[model samples]
Target chain A: MNFILHISKLDKYFDNLHALNDVNFDAKDGRILGLIGQNGAGKSTTFHSILDFIKYNGEITWNGNPINEKTFDEIGYLPEERSLMEKATVQQQIVYFAKLKNRKANWTKPRIKNWMKKFDVKGDLNSKLKSLSKGNQQKIQLICTLIHEPKLIILDEPFSGLDPVNADLLKQSILEAKANGATIIFSSHNMNNVEEICDDLVMLRNGEVVLNGSVQAVRNQFGKNELYVTTPMPKEELRQLPGVETVFVRDNEKYKLKLSNPDAGVELFKLISKGEYIEEFSQQPPSLDEIFREKVGETNE
Target chain B: MVKLMNKFKAIVQETYVNQVKSKSFIILCLLPIIAIALIVIVGLISYQNAASSGNDDTNQIALIADSGIKKSIVQKDGDSIDSSIKTEQQAKHKLKNDDIYGYVKVTKNNDKYTAKYIGNESIDGGVRDDLMQNLSLHQNKLNLSNNNLTSEQIKKLSNKPSFYNYVKSRSNDNKSDDNDIKMGSLQLLIYILYFFLFFYSSITATVISKEKGSKLVEVIFSSTTATKYFIGKITGIVLMMLTQFAIYLIMLFSSYAFLSQADFAKSFIKENSNYVHQIVSNLFNINLLFIIFGLLLGIILSATAGSLVSRREDANKAGQPVFMIVIILFVLSIMFQNNSNSIIPKILSYFPLSSYFFMPIRMINNQANIYEGLISLFILIIFIIGLTYFISKVYKGLMLQNNNEGWFKNLIRGVKYR
Candidate 1:
């Protein structure tokens, strides 16, 4: 099924503060959409609106229909603040949450072992959640979210407190869920993770959708202004090149340059290469991190 | 609707199982039984001690009086007097030897009787009173005989009258007996209601606040609506309460059955069989409906209070208002329990908050009719329904609110969101 979650001009006000203003986005099936924002940027508010957990001034529809109780059964949400029943065993917690999502305990029970192995969770089924390390507990929470096989998965800050290995495990699981034709939408501060996994991206700033598109398209819109070159070119020489705005030394022989325009990249590449062998010469759009800071920094300025 | 109900059932099952399996629940369930067993054991031991002490010969006293006076006074088999010590000299000798507890002397002078009790220490108040009554009775018999009255005439003059009470409001022939049973049942029901309300309200509040504090409500709300979630939670706790009550009832009946096999319990049951039947009947009447509704109100209100806060530490503080209301109503109910016919209690009998306390008391006192009880119950039911609906509406907003704002501010914010 080609499931799609559509939000249309959603607006939310908390007392005198406009928490979300005319926010609009769509998350399609079999794809990962990353919602990114600085602190207090209404990313959670947008998720809340989609989940129908709060009162807002717009409509959120799932597959061209209003989200309802049955839709909720097909939807799984992992909240920003990770919390599970500390007193419950891993199996009990997973089964309980699965049951809430309309899955039978027997069905969830057998799958727990596989998920434990997949996530490398170092606890047995009967181990209490509190007995596990923080990373292992988060893995258990992730298992709870995906065990029901929800078609629409909403995860808020799923990778906030994970080591690189654990984060890679979660990333693999998210991609697996996506491959199974689930609509996965997650919010994160890790721009690298977002850039790596997100097929689509929505950036919110001060309760407004500042940027929205596929990850490649959003990054490409900023042009290939960033250039990394490892050559004999000194920093002073790189700064003197036309169309090069700034020169940054990354290593003993490497230099990174920011172009004032996309056309500047071609000129810069030609100058750095010079029909000779260069160890590294690459020009690409600015990283999502830079774009995020620039967009969020625009407001601060 | 089926899916909604399924989710509701899931929530209820989770809550019920989680709580029923908790150490606190197990401890609470066993606490009363342990306390009851302790009380019974202590009571039996005390009774045995008293019974054994009653037969001590040294604890006995001697009564020395003229033969005419002694013959006129009637004595029971267990009277503390030793008939063997017939003279003052022997009585004094026994007292000095610590063989007797005391000695009493009786004499008549100028048609008046006087008694003197002598011992190393004062006699028991009960023994002294018994001796004084015996001397006064002998004096009365002598006075009547001296007034030219025959013995039969004196006996006729001393006959006591029979007394009975008749209440105009009660339709039963055994009004006083029924009233006694109802009064006793009313107190028991009130105590149960008070205890269950306080206990279950706190449980409901803690359950909600814990979820809120742990930030697990969003995941829960995603699976079900707030109304269904609230109803499911309250229903789950109510079912747990019923299960606990059932356990207690089973324990009570089992204990009764075991005790009934004993000779003392069997005789006691036989003596108070009518009272027991009446009390059981009264417990299952309309008053029970009031208690159920009253408990539901308390639990629902406490749940609302619980939702008003975003942290577990604030849960007890949030519940304080509901607890205060319950405390006030309980106090008022007790104060007006005997004054059911008074205007204040009559007025309170119809109010939902106080009616649970006053209506049952008035009905037992025959100051309120069955119709009034039903009306009060109806009002309570309506109030509970309305409050439940209102709280359910604001529950989502309350659960979503994460501000450190105080409860009242959060409540206002939640209401606005609703």
Candidate 2:
């Protein structure tokens, strides 16, 4: 139940602009923390603060100790930009990174092959990094990031350029790493993917944490007023009913409706059931995407 | 502490291996060796060719005259009696037919004399000296005759003032020769050091900036301090420069040894033995510690400046200060080539930037003693350490700045802000 990582009262400024303002968050030892924000929302800046790459007013600790060079010994960081030497071959690049982490060549050479195989990346070990396609290069970068089996992995926009299949593969790898007890932290604009793998997330708006909790808890806090209805009636009829906010006809002649209140659910059900034969009415908590939009929308207003 | 050392060593090793294996570095290192070897080979071939040609002593030329002074000219000019008189057409025909190397045609026009010399080969220095002497004697006789004086008076006038020039001591001449050799060697060392400082430091800057642009600096900084990264990078480039210098030395020594075994090369080298002896003696006799320490400090200083760059495109901006120092050093080396004894050169030799050029010159001129050189080196070492420490302090924050500002501004800000 103890926090593996914690940052409280984190603040950063670049000139006159405030970048991160008293942002507070934490992650458990074996869970994934999704950092969700738009461009310039301070996700990358938060990561930078934690890694000590920039000067900031903050307190960041891992296992009750202030972060330092030793913190990186057990941590892996994949920068938003590709951090690789293009002219160097795959073997040279991997060995260079591994050696920087104090991994011996004898141990790293075999691990490189094993990781490349697991990632299903097909290329010669001696091939230069620039010769590989973007996806393959990303896979190699990922291997370098994860090969050390670090206790904490911080991936900044890890899925930026990944295709769907590669992203799925990466998701699986991340899950496996989590199962192996590594605390994973990542920042992404893709809400669906974030919801898929993240147990807890912090949503930042204008350098401030507006929503911070487990995905399920945060969604449940937003409350459940959405219902999927399979009916013969037109979707407009549901919108005209009292207590209904909006309705959309989904696939297979089903109408997914958003109600103004959970109490309105009975009214909409009664309205829909009175007119046409209703197949089923199921209510569910709001999606993380809806919660993110709702929280970010308030700040925008 | 052990982990830091290990990371530094790994970074140095990686930089060394990557640069050493690169085609550009390999080619850059090899070019100077190849060029020097080609120069030596070309010099040998041309020397042999010049030796095979007949000596200038054997060539013959004719002197034609239409003046009353012709016989007197020939008698006054020693070694000129071998020439046979001929008309202008005959001389030209002989020259064309290879019967004569060249001919000098003398004719009287108006009241003065005009001489025209043409030949297939350039007139030799000894021949030209004798001809000028004979012509001066003839002009003196003509002047005496026009003054209504007799030949006896002219002869007495020419023979009266016989003066001899002599060196009071050979040791002074040898010392001067040794100084020339030392200065020459020092100038050469200055050029080589300038090349190393300017080229290698710029390379280091480019590498740093390129890594910065790609976010590799973030990855490296995570595991090690900025000081370690700076030291490792500079050390890596220093090792590269040393490797290249070592290879060039090997090539030079091996070539010299190989050439010394051949009779032609040996004889050719012997003809310029005085120069060769001076160079070899200066190489062994000069204080090498000054040169080594000076170069090391200069390169480190340049590398420290280079680390301030944030992007590869602005590498020139980052490296400009070092390049300017090198250019100033080169210009001073040239300006003070013959004036190594001056106070200005000696004073400049104590500075860290110009010392790489000036210290060696002073050492070669025998003006800088061991203690003086060592003191200068000590000051330079201290300066290098201070600059490195200062730059390391700023390097971490400087590298993290995306550098939307100009490189110079970023550099200043990084240093000031830190």
Tens digit of per-residue lDDT, candidate 1, span B49-75: 877987777787887888765554425
TM-scores vs. true structure, each candidate: 0.88, 0.83
**Candidate 2 clashes between residue pairs 3 or more apart in a chain or in different chains:** none
Local lDDT at A282 for model 2: 90
Q: Where is the poorest 10-residue window by lDDT in model 2 chain B?
A: B76-85
- Per-residue lDDT of A48-116 in model 2, one digit per residue for the tens? 888888788978888889888777777888999886886889998888887777777787898888889
RMSD each, Å: 4.4, 6.4
Highest DockQ: which candidate?
1
The model with the greatest TM-score is: 1
Interface RMSD of 2: 1.5
For model 1, how big is the iRMS in angstroms?
A: 1.1
Clashing pairs in 1: none
Task: Report backbone clashes per prediction.
Answer: 0, 0
